[model samples]
Target: MTSAKSSENKQAFINGWKQSKLVRVFLYFILMLVFFLSSYQHLIVSDKNMGENTSEKEINQETPIYSEYSINSLDFLEHIFDKLEQINLDATFTYEEKTEIYKLYFLEEYNKFVEDNIKTMQQSEDSLDAAFIQEIENQLIDQQYDFPVEAFFKLPRLSQAEIIKMSAVAESIVKNLMKEQIKEADIMRGKVAEMVNASNLSDDDSRVLVTEIARFSIFPNYFYDAAATKEALSSTKTTETNYLQVVGLILLVILFVVFLYMYIKQSNLQIRNNNVQLLMLVFIFIINMMGMKIVALGHSLDYPYLGFLAPVALGSMLIAILLDYKLAFISSILFSIFASIIFNFENQMFLFDYRYGIVASVICFTSIFAVHKASQRSSILKAGILITIAACTSITAIFLITNENVISNYIFSLTFALMNGLLTAVFVIGILPFFEAAFGILSPVKLVELSNPNHPLLRKLLTETPGTYHHSVMVANLSEAAAESIGANGLLCRVGSFYHDVGKTKRPNYFIENQVNSENPHDTIDPDLSKSIIISHARDGVEMLKEYKMPKAICDIAEQHHGTTLLKYFYFKAKKQQELTGELEEEVKESDFRYPGPKAQFKEAAIVGLCDCVEAAVRSLSNPKMDQINTMVDKIIKDRLEDQQLNECDLTLKEIDTIAKSLKETLLGIFHSRIEYPELPSRDKKGVTKDEATVSI
Candidate 1:
C-alpha cells in the first residue's frame, strides 16, 4: 500500500508539472532575456559618439536637457544678434555723432584727410595757433553738413570706444550677411538654401544659410549639446537590467514553489499509460520544433505576427490525432504566444493582431470534431483542408475587428491558410510511412487497400482456394462496418480479416472450399486429420504474419478469428458416416474437433471473429433476404456473446447492438436486387440432361 501511494504521488507530481503555468512563465522569461542579450550590440551602436569633456555630472545637471540645449544655445546667439540688429537702426545727426559712429568702421582715409588739412591750415595762417587750428578742425569734425560732406568736414578722429564699437558693428554686419539666399530664385546660393535658415532671407534662403552656418560650426559645444540630449533621452540611470534579473530570479523561485504546491495537492491522481503518454510527449515536442522552425521562417519573411498562426492551423489535426481536444486547445494558445514573440510585436500595421489567436483557436477547436478516430492519410488531408477553411473564417472575423482593406487582407490570409494546409498535408503524408513502419500506426485507408483480393496472399487464395478468398472478402466488409459503428479501429479489423485466411494459400487444394471440379479433399483424410489441417491455418497465419512483421493488432485478429470454436462440419460429417456404416462403436472426442485455445481479446479481433462466422453461414443461402441475413448475423453475435469472446474487450452491449444494426443495413444495401425478368414458356417439369444441369449449377 505504501508503494502504491508513492507511485501515485510521483504520478501526481508529473501531472501537475505538465499543467504548471508558473513553469511556462519562468521559461518564457529566460527565453526573453536570452534574446535581449543576443541582440544588445544594436543598442551599443546607437549610443556611441559623445563629446570628450562632457561629464556624467554635466549631463545630469542639464535642465530638461534636450529643451534647454536647444533654447540656451539660441539665447547666446540671440544676445549677439540683438546688437547686430540695432546697427541698421543707428542714426548720427551731428558731426560728433558721425565721428563717434564712423570711427566704428575704422575710417583711415577720413582720419589722414583731417590731420593733413589741419596742418595745411596752420601753414596758411601763421597767426593762427597750431593748437587753435587743431581745435578748430576737431570742432569742424563735430559738425554735420549736407550733400558732399567732403574730406574736410566729414573726416573724424579715431578713438578707443569708437574702435571697439567699429569691430562690434563689423561682426554684426557679417552675421546678418550670412543669411542664406534662395537657391532656386537666387540661383547663386545652390542647393544649400533648402537646408539653412535665417531671418533676413526668404524661406529657401534661410534654410541654406542655417545649413552652411551649421556646417562651419564644428566646435565641441555644437556636438556636445546634441550628444547630451540624445544620451539623456536614451540612457538608464537606475540600472533596469539588474532589476529585471533580480525579478526574474524571484519569479523562478515562485515558479518552483507553485509547482511544488500543486504536486502536493494532487498527490493521488492516476497517471495514464506510460507508453502512450511518452508517445504523446515526443510527438508534441516534434510538433513544437516544427512550429518554431516555421515561425523563424515567417520572421524572415517579415510577415505580420499572424504568419506564426500558420503552424497552429497546420498542426491542429496532428494534435487532435495524438492528443485529446482540451490539450489541443491549450496548445493553440501556447503556440500563439510563441508566434507573438517571433513577430517581435513591433510593426503591426493592422489594429487587431488578434487574428493569430483567433485563427489558432478556431482551427484547433474545429479539428477536434473533424479528426475523431481518424487514422488515414486521406482523412488527415481532409482534416487539413477543413482547418484551412477554419483559418480563413477566423481571419475574416478578425479583419472585421479593424477596418483594414477587406479583399486584400482576405486574399493574403486565404493564401497563407491554403499554404499552411497544403504544407501540413505534405508533411503529415511524408511522416506517415515512417510512423507506420516504426511505431505501427495502422491507418484506415491503408487497411482498406490491403483488404483487396489482389494482394499476393489473397490472390494466391483466389487462384488456389477461391472459396476462402470469397469468404474473407465478405468478412472484411462485415467487420469494417462493425468496427466503424462501435467507434473502434474499423480499418484495422477489415485488413486483419483479409489476411487472416492467408494460411490457406499454403495447401489450398486440401480444403473443401478449393475443390471446384473435384471430390472433397476431406474424403481422402480421416476426420481427425482434416480437423488438424483446418486448425493449423490459424497457427500458420500467425507465423506468416510474424515473418512479415505485421502489427500485433493485425496478427491478433488473424490468430483469434476462430477462437477455439468446434469444427462442426467435420465432426458432424464424421459422426454421420460412422452411424451410416454401422460403426458407432468408434469413439468421437471433442478435443479432435476444437481449434487451438484463446478467444478474441479486443474489439477488432472479436469483430473479425463474428464476421468470419457470418460470411461462411450466409454464403450458403440460395436466395437470402433481409430476414435470413439478420438471422445469420443475430446467431453469430449471440453465439460470440454467449461464449464470452468479447468479455476482455471494451465493447459494451449497446455498441454491439449498433454494430449489428449497421452491418444489417450495409449488407442490405450491398446486396439489393434488380427487377425480375418476365418468363414466357416453361421447360419439362422433370428438367434437362446432365450437361444442362451441370451448367445451371
Candidate 2:
C-alpha cells in the first residue's frame, strides 16, 4: 500500500511537470536551438571552402606590404615625367643625341628607383612585414633599368609635336591602367591590346608608345597577386555565400521551426504533452539532416548531379508515420529547405533557393501525402514509387529552368531521382521500427495487429470472462464509429476498447458482467469491499498492459477510461444499509466509493471512456429502442461533461454531440433485430430456433 501511494504520487508529479508552462517554453527553445545548430555548420564549412580556392603555392606566398618604406615609391616620379619635353630636337641636339638624351630621363627615373629600394631595405629586414617587403625591395634592386634603345630610337625620329603627342598618350594609358589594383597580366594585356587595335597611328608610332609604356616610361608600380585575383572573381559570383546572407537564412529557418512548434501544439495535443515524443521529433529531424549530408558526398563524384540521389522525402515519411501528418506536412517544408542547402549547386543558402528546393519540396510532399494514412509497412515502398514519379517531373522541371533542353541529357539525373525514391523507402523501412519501438508509439499497423483476438491478453479475456469480452467487443464497435465521426483514430479506439476490460479477467466472478449464473459476490461482502474490487480493475488493467510493454497510449486509455466517477451502485447500497442499521447516512464517505482517476488527457481516451459507459448502460435494457439508445447516450455524455471528465481533452461540445449521435446510430444497428423481436419463436424444420439459426458456428 505504501509503494502504491508513492508510485501514484510520483506519477502525479510527472504529469504536473509535463503540463507546466516552463517545460513548454524550454521545449520550444530546444526545437529552435536544434534547428539553428543544424544550419550553423554551413557557415564553418563555407569558410573552410574559402581557402580551397587557391593552391598551396599560392596560399603560402608572401603578401604585398609596401608601407614599410614605400618601395611602391612612384610618388617621386610625378614631376620627372616632364623631362621628355625638355629636349631641343632641331639644332643643339641631333636626332640620335636627342633620342639618347630622352632615354637618359627614363634612365634617371629608373636609377632613382633602384637606389630608393636599397635605402628602404636598410631600415627593416626585421619587421613583421619584413619578408614580403624585402622580396619587393630585392626585385627592384635586381631588374635592369636600361632604356629600350631599339624602340625608343623611333621616338627621336618624330618632330617635337609628334614626340609630345605620343609621350602624353603613353603616360595617360600607363597611369589609367595602374590605378587602384590590377591583379593579373591578362587585364593589362587586354587593355593594351584593345588600345593598339583601335589606334589609327602608324605601326611605327604605336610600337614606339608600347615600348615606352611597357619598359622605360611607367614607374615600377605594377604588381600582380594571384590570390587577390581569384578572391575578387569568386566574390562577384558567390556573394550569397557571404556571412551576412548565411546568418539571415539561419534566422529564417528558426522562424519556420517556431511555426512548426506552434502547429504541433495546436494540432496534436498528445504529442505536445509528452516531452519524450517531442524529443523524438527533434531526433527525427537530425537523422534526416544527417542523411542529406551523407548523400551530398556524391555531389563531387563523376556521376552527373548525383545529389539528385539524396533521399529528400525520408524525413516527412518518418514523421507521418511516427507522429501527426499535419506536422509532417509542415516539417516537409523545413526538410526540403535543409536538403536544398545540402545539395545546392553554388553553395547558396537562401531559404527558397530554386536550384534544389523545388525538386526536394515535390519529393517531400509526395511522400507525406502517400504515406500519411498508411496501415502497412509496404505502403512506404508504394510511397517511394510515387515519390520517384514526382522526382522525375520535378527534375525535368528543373532542367527546363537550366535550359538543359536536350531530352537525352536528363537521363543521368532522372535515373538518380528514381534512385532517390528507392533510397527514401529503404531508409524509412529500416529506421521506422527503431522509432516505433523506442518511443513506444502506437501506429495504425501496430494497432491493427494488437486488435487481433489471438493475442494472449485478448484471448485470456475471451476465455476467462466471456461476458465482459462480449461487452468489450460491443464497446469497440460503438467507440470506433464515434471516433471516426469526429476525425479521430478509429483503429486506435477499437484496439483500446479490446483491452480496456482485460483487468476484469483477474476477478471474473466479482464483476456483474462476468458473474454468469453464480451468486453475487457483493451479496456476501461489504459494499466497500465490492467497490475496491471494481475500482482495482481499471488500475490492474494499466499494470497488465504495461507488463506486456504495450504502447503508452493504449495503457493510458486503460487507466483513464473510468475517470473519477462515483460508483453509485455500491455507494447508495452502503448508504441504504447504514440507514436501516440505525447509522447516519454520513457514515459512508462518497470519496471512498469513487474511482481514482486523472481524467482523460487525450481525445481517444475520452471517446473510449464515454463509449464504455454508454455500451454497458444500453446493454442492460431488455429491448433498447433508437430513442431509448439516444437518451442513454446523451445522459452518459452529459454526466461526463458535468463531472468535468472531458475537461482535459481538446474535444469541443459540437464534436461531443456528433459523437453521441454516432454512438446511438451504432448501438441501434447492433441491437436492431434484438429490439424488433424480443422473444424466440418455435423451432424450424431443421430444429434450430430463429436466434439459433442466425448465430455463427
Candidate 3:
C-alpha cells in the first residue's frame, strides 16, 4: 500500500509537470536566456572600448594610403640645415655681407618648410614619416649659398668655407648655438610624435589618456581641444548606446515571453475558473516591468541603485500575500539579480553591491512573516513600515562605500528607501481584493463576514431554531480556541464551525434539540427511519454549501466535520425496533450507518469535529457549574483523543492541551453569571398595604 501510494504521488508530480504546455515552458527558457544575454551585453558595453579598435581598422581600410610622418618635424629640421648653410656663406665674406646672407637664407627656408609641411600636411596616413624626413634633408642640401665678404664678417652668418669648417668644428661657438636650438626643436618634435603615435591607437590602450583628460578637465590650467577630443570621447558612448538599445530589445522580448508563459499557464489551470490568476500574473509582470523601467531611467540619469526599491517592495508583498514564503524568498533572490542589472549596471556607483539584495531580502522575509499573520489591510501598512526601515538601513550601508559625494548619494538612497515602503503598501491594498474574490481565498475578512451573527442563514437559525444557533455559537467558540491553541488558523476553524450545522436548519423539528415546541417526530417512526433523518444532515449541509457556491475550504469543513464515525446510538435503536416489529433480518452494516467522508485532514477540520460534539453534549446539561463545564470539556476532548478522531490532523498533544485550556477559559467566561441588586418595598407610614409602594435602595 505504501509503495502504491508513493507510485501514485510520483505519477501525480509527473502529470503536473507534463501537463504544463510546451509553449509556456519554451517561453520560460527563452526568457532566462535573454535575461542572461542582456546582462552580459550590459557588462560588455560598459567597457567603453567595446569595438573601438575594430571600428578604427574598418575606417583605415576605406581611407587612401600615404607615407606616415610628422611633415612639421621634417620642415623644422630643414630650417636648421638651411641656417647652417647660410652661416657657411658669410664665413668667407667680409663683415658687411654677413647680415644680408643670413636674412636671405632665413626667409627662404621659412617659406619653403611652411609650403611643404605646415600648409599641405594631413595628420595620419599609411606609413611612417621616414621619406618625408629624407625629402626635408635633400631640400636643405639643395639650397645654394653665395660667399660674400660682408656675409662672412656678419655676426649671425658664416662663410661657406667656415660652414664646411664648422661641420667638422663641433666645438665652435656657432655650432654650439645651432645645436641648442636643434635640441629644443627635437624635444618639441618628440612630444608631437608621441601625441601622433597615440592618435589612432587601440581603445584598450586609451585609458591613460581618458584618465588624463578627466583629471585635467577638473582644472582650467589644462588645454584640451574640445573639437579634436570630441570624436574619441563620444565613440565609446555611441557604441554603448547602440548595445544598450539592442540589449533592451532583447530583454523586452524576454519579459514579454515570460509574461505570456505565466499568463497561459495560469489560463490552463482547470481550477482557475476564469482569467483571474492570469490577470494577477500579468499585473505582477507589469509591476516588474515598471521596476525595470525605473531602473533603466535611473541609470540613464546617472543615479544608480535607485530603481532597486520598487521591485523589492512590490515583489516582497506579492510573494507574502499571493504565494508562500518559500516561493517568496526564491523570487526575492531572482529579483535581487534583476535589481543588480537594473540598479548597478554600466553607470553604477558600485560593482556587485550587496545592499540592494540585502535590503530586498530583508523586506521579503519581513513581508512574508508579517503578512502571514496579517488579518487586515492595515496590517500590510505595518509590514510596509518594517520594509521601509530595512530598506533605509540597506541603502545607507551602500552609501557608505559611495561617500565621495555624500550629500547626493545620501539623498538618492533615501528616495528609494521611502519609495519601498510606499509601493509595498499600495501593492498590497490593490491586489488583495482581486485574489480574495476571484480565487475565493478564505482571508480573515471573509472568515469574519461569515462568522457574523446577522448573516441571513445564521439569523434564520437563530429565529427558527434557537437551540441549533446556540449550539453553533458554542461550537464556534470551542473550535476557535482549539485551533488557536494548536497553532492552526482559529478564525477559519470558528467560521467553519458556525456553518457546519446549517443543514439542521432544514428539518429543525425532526432534530431532538431543535424541536422545542414540536412533538417528537421520531416516536412513531421506525428506528431505521429516525437514524436516516439524523444522519442525513451532513450530506444535506454539503449539498447546501455547494449550492451557495461556497469556497472549497468551507465546503471541506461541511463534508469532513462528521468523518466516518459509526452512528452507535441510532444503529442500536434500529436493531431493537427490528426485533420488536418482527421484521425479517436484513443485512445491517456499520459502514451503512456512517458518514461518507474522506475524513478531516487538517487541524481546523478536526477541531470543528470536536467542537461539534462538545457543543451538543455540553448544552444539554441544565444549569452547569464551572466544575461540571470543565469535566464535560475534558470528557469530550478525552473521548475524541481515545477514539483517535484527531489522528488525521497534524496537531500535537501539547497543542491539544493548550486547546483544552483555552476552551475551558472561554467557556467559563461565557457561562459567567450576572448579579442583580434587590430593592426593598416601603409602605407609607401605615401597616396596611398602600396604593403605591416605594422602592428603597
Candidate 4:
C-alpha cells in the first residue's frame, strides 16, 4: 500500500510538472546557472598565481607583488637606460650612469652583469622624483651637507675632473654594495658605512662618495620577481574547474528549492496554487541574488566591507508584505547562504564571510518580522530603523568577535549597514504597489485603503442603497469581532463585508434592506423568479467588484458568502404554494432554489458569510433583546454548520462556537441601547422569528 501510494504521488508530481509548472522549473534551472556564473570567481579552487616565483601559493589582488633582482635585473638595467636616455643623461657623468657605462664598455660585462645593478622597479616619474629627493636627504650617515662650501661649488654639480673622480668612487662603492646583495632600505646607510670604512680613498672622500651611491642604490630587489609573476598571472587561466564546489553548489541549490517547496506545501499552500504569487516569489528571489552579486563586486574597490551596503533583506521583506512571513523566513535563510558565498573573500578559496552573512541574516530577520503585517507606508520606515539597529548590532558583535577593532572600519561598516536597512525598506515600499497591481495580490496597506468609507464603491453603496450600506456596516462590525475571536483576518472580513451586498446598487429595491418604502419587488414576482433574483446578487456583487478592480479576496467573499445554501424563504414559499396546488416536495427540487457556490474556501470568507447572516437575522427583529440576539446568533451559526457550509474552510467546530459567541456579544452591544426603547408587544409574533436568518433573501 505504501509503495502504491508513493507511486501515485510520484506520478501526480510528474503530471503536474508537465501540465503547468514546467516553465517555472526551467526558470529556476536558469537561475542556478546565473548563480554559478555570477559566483564563478570565488568558486575557483586552483591557485591564480601558479608560478614558482610567487612568494605565496595563494594570491589575491591585495597581495603586493615583487620583482627579484636576478630575474628582472637585466630588464631593470634596460629600463634605467631608456629613462636616462630620454633625459639626455651622460652615462659616464653620475655614479648610477658610470656603473652602467663601466659594465657595458670598460668591463665589457654588460651581458654578464645586471644593468646598473638597479634594485627597484621603475615607478611613475613623479614618484621616482619624490623618492630620489627624499632618499638623498635621508639616506646619508651625516645629517649636514656643506652649505657654506656649496656657495663656492654645489655638491651635485662639481667641476668636470672632480665629477669624474667622484663618479668613479661612487661607481666602485655601488658595485661592492650590489655584490653584498643590499636588500633592506632601513640598513642601506649602515651597509654604506661598512663599504666606506673599507674604501681605499680618504675617509672624507669615501664618506662623501658613498652618500651619492646610497641615495640611488638602497631598495629591496633580490625578491620575488614581479615581472615574471605578472607574466605568469596574465598567462595563467583556470581551465580546470572545481567540479566539487560546482556539484556542491548545485546540490545546495536543489536542496534549497526542495526545502522551499516542502515549506510552502505545508504552511502556505495558497502560494503554491497561485501562479502570480509564485511568479512574484521567483522574481524577488532572483532579484535578491543579482543585487547581492552586484553589491559584492563593490568589495573589490577601496572600501573594506562594501557588501554591507547590499539590501540583503529586500526579498524577505517583500515576501513578508506580499505573502506570508513564514515563507519569508525560508527565503531569508536561503538569501543568507547566497550572501555568505557571494560576499566572501577573506577566507581561503574565498568560500565564506560569516560577518557579512550574519549581518545580512540579522537584517532579514528583523525586516520580515517587523513589517510582515504592517498597514501603512510609514510602518515600513519604522521597520527599516529597526533593521538598522539589528544590522549594526550584528556588525558590532561580529567585529568584536573577529577582533577587527579598527574604529574607522567600524564606523564605515555601521554607515553602510544603515544604508542597507534604509534601502531594503525603501525598495520594498517603492516596488510594493507595482507588485500588487502586477500580481493581483492585496497587501495590508492596500487592504486598509480599500476599507476607507469614502471609497467609490462604498460611496456608491451609500448613495444608491443606503439600507444595504447600513446593513453591510453592521455585518462588518460583527464579522470583524467574530474573525478576531477566531484568529482569522478581521480586517479582510470587515473590508469584505462593506462590499458584500454592493450588487443591490444595480437594482436597489429588489433587496428588502434597500427598500425604504412599502413597495416590494419580490411580492409581484413568482417564487421561482424571486429565487433567481435573490441568487443573482452574489454573482452580481462579484461582477461589480471585478469591474472596480477590487482584490480577489473581496470579490471571492462576495461570490462565496452565500455558499450553495438554500434560499429558504423563496423555496419554502414556493413549496407551500405548490402543496396547495397538490405538488409533492420531491417535484420541487431543493437544488433549484440554492445559490450557485464554491463554498467558503477560507476562514475569512466563512466568518464574513456567517456574520452576514447573523447580523441580518438580528436586525430583522423589531426590538431584539439581548437574549433574543444571542439565540439568533447561535441559531444562524448552527444552521450554517448543519448545512455543511463551513466544511471547505479551515475553521474548526471550536472556532465556530467562538465566532457565534463573539457575534452575540457584538450584536448585544449594537442593540443594547434599543432595549431602553418602548417594547412592541407584537414584536415576537410566531411566524416573524421562525426564519429570521432569511430576512435579506
Question: By lDDT, who's the top model here?
Answer: 2
lDDT of 1 by residue, 414-531 (tens): 7888777676667766765555555555645456556666766667767777788877878888888888887676677778888888888777777666767888778878887888
Worst 10 residues of 1 by lDDT: 180-189
Cα lDDT of model 4 by residue, 1-697, tens digit: 9998999799777546533676567655765665666565566453443233223223334443332232332233334334334322443466545444433441233323322322222332323233333332232223322222211122333334544454555555555445433234444334455555555556464355445434344444334334434543454443333456567777766776778777876863466655556777878887888888888778646565788899988899898988888888888988887788888755543577788778878899999889977988888999999999998899889888876434556788899988988898888888888888877677888888898889999999999889999999898998999888966778889999999989878788888887776789788889999888888888889999999889889999999998989988888989888899986746788999998997998899998898888878878899888889878877888888899999988888888888888987888888885335785433354545434635736
Segments in model 4 whose C-alpha atoms lie over 4 Å from true places: 1-40, 47-241, 251-279, 299-303, 346-350, 385-415, 484-487, 516-521, 575-592, 622-634, 641-644, 647-658, 661-697
Give lDDT for model 2. 0.72
- What local lDDT score does residue 452 receive in model 2, on the 0 to 100 scale? 82
RMSD each, Å: 20.8, 15.5, 18.5, 15.0
User: Rank order by TM-score, top first?
Assistant: 4, 2, 3, 1
lDDT of 2 by residue, 82-136 (tens): 4544654457778878777766766676777667665654564443234444545
Between candidates 1 and 2, which one is better according to TM-score? 2
**CA lDDT, every prediction?**
0.56, 0.72, 0.58, 0.70
lDDT of 4: 0.70
Give the TM-score comparing model 2 with the true structure, all chains together: 0.63
* TM-scores for candidates 1 onward, in order: 0.52, 0.63, 0.53, 0.64
Q: Tell me the number of clashing residue pairs for each predicted model.
A: 13, 0, 25, 3
- The CA-based lDDT of model 1 is what? 0.56
Name the lDDT value of residue 444 in candidate 4.
Answer: 85
Better-scoring candidate (lDDT), 1 or 3: 3
Error of 2 at 597 (Å): 2.9
Ranking the candidates on lDDT from highest down gives 2, 4, 3, 1
